[model samples]
Target: MYNALQSYTSYPFAHLVFGEGGDRKTLNFDHRINILQIQGLKVPNQKKKPQDYSEIEALSKALLTPITAYTDQFSRMDNSLFKIIGWDEAWAPLSSDIGEATMDSGIREGRSRNTSFALASQNPTDIKGELMNNIGNKFIFNLDDPVQIDRALEILKLEKNEKNRENMTLLGNGECFFRDIYGRVGRLQFDPLFQELMNVFSTTPPSEEDTEAIHQAIQAHTEVMV
Candidate 1:
């Protein structure tokens, strides 16, 4: 039986909302405190020497990007994106001449915050070592086996409310079928949060949007029924 809804404190469920990391500081140290202010911005300070307040202000004004080091001729914008603001004025004159950068520039992936959230919560027991390749690994469950099916059901049961016995029974078998057959080979990987999201999503009355999200989530995560 498939449950229409379940408690979201555990796996596949927790994995979805917080992702799989159980980690909170996904963003860099400086930006983490002020994430909203620095997604697509950049500011370059003076040389290594922090002679005075201007350098501190420059450091504060610019933002961190995917690439750490920036060249001489660089800019964030008049209010522009870090990469698109001032290309020729900075990069060419400097890069073409001394082959050294006077100004360096780049942009951080804005969605990094979203990515971190997707992997913030995870099941350490469900997680295996040596396969840290990614949180979302793919494996199909083979539910034909009764024992394994029970295990998967147990996971669902533990996470569901007491009132939803009917739904639990409904999807329990199918959950088993999926885990044993397709999911046994390896851990579902991508972002661990995908599983958690699906665990929550699966119980929300399978609609067109939800079903698609479930399928995608399932495809993206490594599955372990317990």
Candidate 2:
């Protein structure tokens, strides 16, 4: 997901606003992508981040502004001003008061503004009921857990046949069952080159910190020589 977002930044007019729990410090900060780091929303006197709903509310308002503006000014246009808003681990905000309102509105009305949302979550049940119902596309990965598999099957409205359930459990890495809004379903294997690129760009916190330190050291050395 991180690598994919990084690649997207290369496109013109593409704006990325990542939410909390994203690796803002590493990937986003290093790449200079705009991030909404919840940790930065500190309370005036308190030592911890803001506990009230205000922060998220502000974020929700900010997110809707562009869509609203685009809708008003360019509703007749065929293309969207902002192409995509990728929501990683979307369940967290989707369950919130502001998140529910923003997501609902975006899903229903964002198309006029030429915007679409891409949501990702570990469990289908974690998504809001309405949002889950309205999702046009779905990708089902391997799930060994009976409870999760049952939930996925229910969401997909798949017949509870033994063969279908077994197939869900046996999906290999980089393999997924793809379903489109029109009810088309098929198995897809991602390209090997794409998977290799993702693996190469994947980074953890410790590695990010070390990389940043090295970067700063190189900058300092270059400055001294200059």
Please tell me which predicted candidate would have the highest lDDT against the true structure. 2
Report RMSD for candidate 1.
Answer: 24.4
Which stretches of candidate 2 lie above 4 Å from their native place? Answer: 1-82, 192-196, 200-226
Prediction 1 TM-score vs. true: 0.15
lDDT of 2 by residue, 8-75 (tens): 34322234244345445432212323433332221132222445536433444444445333423333
Give the clash count for each candidate.
59, 1
Model 2, 195: alpha-carbon shift in Å?
Answer: 5.8
Task: Rate residue 97 of model 1 by lDDT.
Answer: 14
**Mind sharing the TM-score for model 2?**
0.57
